[model samples]
Target: MSDTETLNKLRGVISKLARELNTTATSEGLTPTQASVLGLIVFRGPLGLTELAQLEGLNPTMLSRVIGKLTELGLIQRDPNPADLRAIQVESTEAGRELSDRIKHHRTEAIAACLDQLPETTAQTIINALPALEALAQALRSTHN
Candidate 1:
C-alpha cells in the first residue's frame, strides 16, 4: 500500500480509538459538552461566554445553558470582565481542576495498557512520529485559519 493510504487508515483507527477513549473518560463526570468546556478552560485559560461559544461552535443560548449547568454543578464560575460589564469570563474551579487531573490519569493508564499490546518497534515508531505529526497538524491549522 502507498504511504498516503497507510496514513489515512492509521488516522481512521486513531479517530475510533479517541472516541473509545472519551466514552469512559466522559461517562461519570460530565457530559461531552461540559467536559469539552472544562478542557478549554483548563488548557486555554478563562474565556468570556461569547468567546467560548465561538470556539465550541455553539449558539449563545445553548452556551448559556451549558454554562448554567456547569455553574450549578460548581465546576465552573463566571466573573464579570472588568472592561466589559456585559461579558462574563468562565473559569474552572479547584474541583474542576481535580476532576480534569483525574480524567487525565485514567486516560493515561488506559492508553498505556493499549500501547503495551503493541510490538516494541511499532510503539517506538508512533512515539518518534508524534513530533512530525504535531508539526504537520500545526501547519494544517494555519492553512485552515
Candidate 2:
C-alpha cells in the first residue's frame, strides 16, 4: 500500500481501539478522560499538574476539574512539588491503581478473545507488530512536544 493508504489504515485501527478502550472506561463509571488521566498517573505518575495537563492535551482548568473529581473519588492525591513549591504533583492512590489494573485486564481479555478468533498467523503478526507500534507511538509523542 502507499504511505498515505497505510497511514489512513493505522488511523482507522487506532480510532477503533480507542473507542473500545473508552467503552471499558465508561463501563467502570468513569469518563474516558478520567480513566486516561488515572491510568497515566498509575503508570507515569507523581507528575506535576502542568506536565500532566500537557501529556493529556487538557487545559489547566479542565485538568483541574478532572483532578478534583478523581480526588473526590479517592483515586488520586495531590502533593506539593518539591522542586517547585508553588506547583503540585499528582499520583494515583491505591484505589486508582486498582481501577487502572482492572481496566487493563478487561481491555486485554477483550483483545485476546478477538485474537483467538483470528488465524494463528494473523494473530502472531499482530503480536509481532507491537514493538514497531510502540516505537511509532514514541515518535508521535516526541513530535507532539
Candidate 3:
C-alpha cells in the first residue's frame, strides 16, 4: 500500500482502540483525560506538573485542574518536588494504582479474548508486528516532544 493508505489504516485502528478504551474509562466514572493522567502517574510518576502537562498535551492550568480533581478523589497526591522545592510533583496513591491496574487488566483481557477468535496465523502475525508497532509509537511520541 502507499504510505498514505498505510497511515489511514493505522489511524482507523488506533481510533477504534481509543474509543474502546474511552468506553472503559467512562464506565469507571472518569473522563478519558482523567484516566489517562492517572495511568501516566501510576506508571511514570513522581512527575512534575510541567512535565506531566507537556506529556499529556495539556495546558498548565487545565492540568492543574485535573490534578485537583484526582487529588479530591484520593487517586493521586501532589507534593513538593524534591528536585525543585518550588515545584510540585504528582504520584498515584495506592487506590489509584489499584484502579489503574484493574483497568489495564480488563483491557488486556478484552483484547486477548478478541485475539482468540482470530486465526492462529493472523494472531501470531499481530504479535510479531508488535516491535515494529512500538517503534512507530515511539517515533510518533518523539514528534510531539
Who wins the lDDT comparison? Answer: 2
Off by over 4 Å in 3: none
Best by TM-score: 2
**Against the true structure, what is every candidate's RMSD?**
2.6, 1.5, 1.5
Residue range with the least summed lDDT across 10 consecutive positions in model 1: 23-32
Clashing pairs in 3: none
- Report the lDDT of model 1 for residue 29: 64
Candidate 2 displacement at residue 69 in angstroms: 0.9
Off by over 4 Å in 1: 1-11
User: Tens-digit lDDT track for model 1 on 29-75?
Assistant: 67767777777887777888878887777898888888998889887
Clashing residue pairs in candidate 1, if any?
none
TM-score of each: 0.83, 0.93, 0.92
What is residue 75's positional error in candidate 2, in angstroms?
Answer: 0.2
List the candidates ranked by lDDT, beginning with the highest: 2, 3, 1
- lDDT per residue, candidate 2, 39-85, as tens digits? 99999979999889999999999999999999999999999999998
Instruction: Compute the lDDT of residue 96 as modeled in candidate 3.
Output: 96
In angstroms, how far off is 16's CA in candidate 1?
1.0
